[model samples]
Target chain A: MIICKVVGHVWATKKEEHLNGQKLMVVRETENGGGTYVAADLVGAGIGELVLVISGSTARMALGGNNTPSDMAIVGIIDNLEMETT
Target chain B: MIICKVVGHVWATKKEEHLNGQKLMVVRETENGGGTYVAADLVGAGIGELVLVISGSTARMALGGNNTPSDMAIVGIIDNLEMETT
Candidate 1:
């Protein structure tokens, strides 16, 4: 999973039928200035929250096998990341 | 799906049991000098072929829902890509 921050929302009145009712968000990877991509919200993640995203086909699995043509999905809301001072 | 060229192969004898019997190949995205990632080969793609890859959980779907921890899989071989000259 990649770390991302919910930046904004994406809406379309007409789109793929399977994509209806899906909440789309614009997210940018948290590290290294990764490019942004549209992701479906699986968890109730909010804007500016750190989220865990699983992309590609794994993302579609979150839609109950809907095959929505989306390649990214927010999978979790991360609380923190602690590193060991080794 | 991303277009990539097969650069090399990876082998791990000891790994998640679910990952056993999976063939791993190193791929470089065709458009950008995108960093490499290990991808499971679903098609019998060769070393020099340009391939279409579906990554993340979609990759695991190629494994029959085994939930194999893989994140990328080669979905097709690219024979031609035609674009209109406008």
Candidate 2:
């Protein structure tokens, strides 16, 4: 899983049939200036919210085992990050 | 799919059971200087070779779909990129 912020939305009239009704959002990784990528919203994540994104087969499994054709998906809205202060 | 260059190799004596016998390599995306990620090599790609890396369920499918835990896999070695000049 990767930590990212929901930065924007994607509106597509023509896309893969499996992508119908899926909410796509633009997410940028919070650390390391990671590249931005579109991810399906599975957890009602809002713009500017810190989210957890899962990719690959784990992404598919998150949506109940359907062939959604989505490589990435926002699975959780993170409340906070717990860090161990040494 | 993403285009990347094999920059290095990863050797592990102990790893996930599913990752056993897998060839893991460090790949850096050629375009946009994308972040580096470890990918399982499915096409016998060597260091310094430009290759195609597939992610998500596609990676698992390329390996015959036996539930490999890998999220990224080098599927092809690119000889060249064809671009059309306007």
Candidate 3:
């Protein structure tokens, strides 16, 4: 999992049937500045909120089963993230 | 999953027991330059080779079972990747 900032929404009506009823949001990596990618939202994340993103099979499993075609998902809304400065 | 370029190797003698005997290679996203991350190599990929990477539960499944603690994996060596620029 990684920390990301919810940047935008992806409104897709013509998408995979498995993705129906799922909320898709664009998130950018907070720590590494990894470019934005679309992720299914489970935590009702608002734009500009810092969130925790998980990818792969874990993503699909989190959505209830392995039928969903999600490769990434917002699993948590982070309240605080502490990092030590070296 | 996405296409990435193998840039280097990760030599770790002390790692998760499930990771033993697995080859870990560092990959950088090819198109987006999404920076670098380490992935277990499923295919025989070498440095500078373009490969297909999969993450999350799919990675752990590809490694064999749920016992492996892998989140990313190199699944294929790309012979070619075609994209049309608009």
Q: DockQ for all models, in order? A: 0.07, 0.08, 0.09
Name the better of 1 and 3 by DockQ: 3
Local error of candidate 3 at residue B21 (angstroms): 35
Error of 1 at A65 (Å): 0.9
Candidate 2: count of backbone clashes, pairs at least 3 residues apart or interchain: 1
Q: After superposition, how far is residue B47 of candidate 2 from its true place, in Å?
A: 30
Query: After aligning candidate 2 to the native by TM-score, how far in Å is the CA of B65 from where it should be?
Result: 9.2
Highest lDDT: give the candidate number: 3
What is the descending lDDT order? 3, 2, 1
Chain A TM-scores in order: 0.89, 0.89, 0.93
B21-60: candidate 1 lDDT, tens digit per residue = 8777767676654545557788988787899988666677
Interface RMSD of 2: 9.7
lDDT by residue for model 2 (A1-86), tens: 89988877655443334556877776778775565666779999998899999887677667556455556789999998996645
Query: In candidate 3, how many clashes are counted?
Result: 2
* Model 3 DockQ vs. reference: 0.09
**All candidates: TM-score:** 0.52, 0.53, 0.53
**lDDT by residue for model 3 (A1-86), tens:** 98888876645433334557887776778676465566789989998899999887678789777556557789999998789955
lDDT: worst 10-residue window of model 3 chain A: A10-19
Instruction: Give the Cα-based TM-score of candidate 1 against the true structure.
Output: 0.52
